[model samples]
Target: MTPRPADQRFDVVVVGAGVIGTAIAARLSSTSARVCLLEATDDVAEGASKGNAGITSSYYAAPGTLESDVIATSYRRWDDVCRRLDVPFRRIGAVMAALTSDEADGLPGELANAKACGVAASIVSGDQARRLEPLIGPDCIQGLVLPDEGIIDPMRLCVGFAELAARNGVQVRFDSPVIDIESQDGRVVAVITPQARIETSFVVNAAGLFADQISELAGGTNFKMWPRKGEYWLIDRDWGRTLRHIVFAAPLPDSKGIHVVPTTNGTALLGPSVTDSDRRYDKTTDAEMLAHVTEKTKRLVPSVPMDRAIKAFAAIRPASEKKVRIEVDEVVPNLVHAINRSTGVSSSLGIADRVAELLAGAGLDLTVRTDALDHIPTVRRLLLDPEPETLAALDPRYTQVVCACEDVSAAEIQAALEMAVPARSIDGVRKRTRATAGRCQGSVCMAGVTFMCSLAQNRAPGDVVVTAAGTAGA
Candidate 1:
């Protein structure tokens, strides 16, 4: 995947386009330095960012952990950032349920940990928990209520971050995987991607699953990362509307046990049962594990409607003993490694700020630009709007629904393909515009969406795949 020749130069190059990488790129855009964001996939958030519980947790790790500090720092900023970027975010609270006496005994410990992390949490009786969310199982004895735990559209959040970064003069290139690193005198000079050799003084390895390999290529720290897979079932909005808050299982040491988490799209996400594996790109879902997830989540909330299943998705986060890794590479000073095993979407903004600080300490001029944009233009979503007639007048293409289940219009799909980091495939359009991601799962509108994508990309319909172009698997 080596490029032919060196083409362009930049002051900083940010690798990966997950939520963390995009956030870092957006933060770097405020500086005067020339920044470029590179993604190995066909679009942003094709990694763990694409598939997650999507909860903006108020408290995740232990006290004083970098993960906790980052989550705390970014917790209060979501309201302002989401407003500016027009990202969908719901500040719905979460209830950590305990179904037995042994699990209930851990409630006080959870409360203490939340307080130590400066999170707003309190212990509630099962009665109060049931009152808070009537969907709770009758067997629950106690609950830890986190009022700040919220749900967000992680895909839109990442997209908005990259969009604002691109608007502020940060170049973004997709389908460009880093092939090699060129160093001179123990300093990174350029990065070799499949598309071109990008000359840069600074390189940030924010690649999620392949971050360790990126570090190895840059002559950075020696570390290994294994994939920690989590399986989840997407419940339709019909049942999602019945759940008021997130219901969680009592906890496990290495993972948060299966739970029923809500998403910003008015749907609920269940399970996310964790499994350790060496496979980096295994997005396959297991029926047995899925059944386990369903059963566990049912115990968490007995009233949950299991018949309202939309689909199943799996995501694997890069895991290591260290939960958060945001520091300058010991072997390569200019090459910074920014890796967050978990809480990536929740702690993304803080990670970006921390990475910027590291880059500044490394002699990169990070004087904030006065003329940088504070926000990008707003996107009109049919789901959020009440007056479809008014919208159809502004653009008649809005009258043509490309995704009936999601209320996605042809105009929205077109805009997705013509954005700062435009959609290149059918999955790209689905990620941005939710065109093919509805309850129908593109069964009714795949042909129309594919035709539109074909016309926009100037390729035959056969060339377009349902998934992103450079994705690892189905």
Candidate 2:
């Protein structure tokens, strides 16, 4: 890899390209700040952002906590934010179903918490729960209806934030991991990566899983970080179309319990059994855990079509002593720490605004930038309207169907590769266009995707890796 020219200067440097970091970068760029966003991988959302169920939660945390505040703030503006960013969001609402007396007992308290948090929620009878979600088990005793609970495409949200930030001239560096932080007199001055040393007025530590390392390296806070693995199954739209809203079993103190969630792309999600793991990057799915998840989810929706499942995967959220921290470091005056174990997607917008306030308080000029762009150009998806004659008229490549399962066309694949934060690997293309993410899971379309990636990225077909996880192309 080539090295960046030495010692580039910026007003701020955000340390990760996950949703939190990207959102912060996007928000900060709307200022006159010369910002830089650094990521370790070839593309964004390589961590928990890509792996988890994309639910933009609104009612999970305690009403008075920082987590709840951020989530509540973002929840109010979710529709506006999604519209401007062109991210697909569904405020389809969610139902927390209770099957036992103990579970039913918790619904009133949760409803009260929701009210205090300014969320619209109500307790309902078992019959009402079954009526709202026909798939709910007949055994459900009670339910809590949260009308503002939403779903969002985390991949697209991160992509949108990165693109908008880039549009505002924020320098985004991929494959650039911060190796060191240079500070003097308890103030951060520079971030050292393998390729460049970026001088900055302040640094935002939003590295997600590896955030502790960043905080420690900056001589700031001392916090430990680990992975809490959650495994999930993705079902095809055949079964996905049957679900009307996101379904959840009454929450456990430690976990949200197993959920039956629907994706924006018309697929269903199940499992996501939470297991505490010490491994920071272990994403392997377990047969026992998956079995547990499948059985638990069935309690909420008995006919959870396991046979229609297309994929099984796992992602780990950052777990630490502090569940969430969004404050300036005590030891280092200019190092701002932003960490959230879960709900990073739900609270991203509010977190960005808070980080902006922290930066401005620390003496950075965050005057709203008039020149920054508010939106990116929108593209008409061929698959969304796959009228062959009409689509082929707009672009010849629209006629060339690349992924039969998702109906993704060559035109869409080309356009994904041409985005501001372009896809460079087969997996990147899948995230952008869903080419290999359908029923067959790339078995039928990997070659075509590899070819398209190779052609657009200007590499030999064999040179492109099948995934960012170092799976070499065959």
Candidate 3:
């Protein structure tokens, strides 16, 4: 690992590369400030951003709260942001079904919350809910319809932010974990990593699960973050194609309950059983938890094809005493914290704006850059295009499909490898191009994808790893 050149000072250094941090970095890039985004992992979206349900909820937060405010603002801006970045986002809407009268009684409260938050919501009878989604279980007695709720690709969302930030002159340094935050006279001075010592007056602690640890290094408030694991099951696209909208059980006191979501890429997402745990980085799924997920999901949408389940994974959300904390540090000057449990993605754009405003009020320059790029070229996906012959004529590599399950071409893989924030591993390329994320789960296309990655990295096929420090030839 080579160190960043000496005397590289930045106006602001943002820690973590999750959706929140990347969003802030991207927003800050619009200014003339010299900004740098630091990530402990080899690539972005390696934490809570990579896994978890991808729904952009319209009214998940309580009214008059910071989360609700951000969610409302983000809901309005999400479509434009996705279009500008060329990321996949769909406004398919969502239905929260109630199987019992007791549950139905809670619908009024939810409807009120939606009204207070300015989110469009309506209460529908069970038959009306069935008309909206025929596959909903017969046990559903009533439901709440949220027409603006949608799903998005979390990987593309984070990657687009980072790529756009990089295009606008924001330096992205991967594999750089902050070892210490030096302060003098109650103000941040420099950030020390093993590979570099960056001089900066301000630092934003958006480190997700490790935000508390990062704050401690900066001598900020002592906030503890516990990990809450959410396990998910990915159903095959063949079954997902039948589902027209996101279906959910009524919200519980402590959790959102299980949901059946039709993702933007045509696959269905289910589960996310919230379990309180002490382990900070435990992402392992258990048989018992997964079994509960299938049972609960079936209760909501009995027609869901559990037999077509293709993958099971887990993500850890950062649970804090305060449900969400997004404010400048009280004790440490020039330091900010953006922490949340499950609504980070849905609230990211608003979070970025608020963080930028805070930085400006704190005396950081917010001069607009005239040469900043506004958009990046959308990667050409064969599955999305209607005429393959037209694309094949432009680049012969477009015709050479590498991952048949995903219809991903060699050209797309190579294109991802050459992006502003280029892919460094097979998983990186998967997040960018969906090369090996299909029904087969890479069993059929792993070899071809690995060979391509090997060629891209100038390494032998046997030595290729899925991600940084991951298993070779996985």
Q: Which ten residues in a row have the lowest lDDT in candidate 1?
A: 465-474
Ranking by lDDT: 3, 1, 2
Give the Cα-based TM-score of candidate 2 against the true structure.
Answer: 0.96
Global Cα RMSD, each model:
2.3, 2.4, 2.2
The global C-alpha lDDT for each of the candidates, from Candidate 1 onward, is 0.88, 0.87, 0.89
lDDT by residue for model 1 (1-474), tens: 443456999999999999999999999999899999999877889998988888898988888988888998999889899988778888899999998899999889889999999888999999999999999989988999999988889999998999999999999998899989988899988899866888998999999889989988888888899999999999888788788898889988877789898777678899887889999978899999999998998898876777789899899988976778999998998998888887999999999999999999999999899999979777788877767678987888988988988889998988988888778778888888888787899889988998988788787777776775332122
lDDT of 2 by residue, 232-303 (tens): 999899889789889988888977888999998889999677778788978899889898988898888999
The TM-score, computed over Cα atoms with residue i paired to residue i, of candidate 1 is: 0.96
Clashes of 2: 0
TM-score for each candidate, following the candidate numbering: 0.96, 0.96, 0.97
Over 4 Å off in model 1, which ranges?
1-5, 386-389, 469-474
For residues 1-474, could you state the per-residue lDDT of candidate 3 as single tens digits? 343444689999999999999999999998988999999999999889999688898877789899888787798778889988878888999999999999999999999999999889999999999999998999999999999998899999999999999999999999999998788789888898888889897899999999999999999999899999999999988889889889989999877889999988888989889988889868899999999999999999988887899899999998899877889999987999988788999999888988888888888999988888877788767877778768887788998898887789989998888899998888999999888899887888888888887888899888887877674554
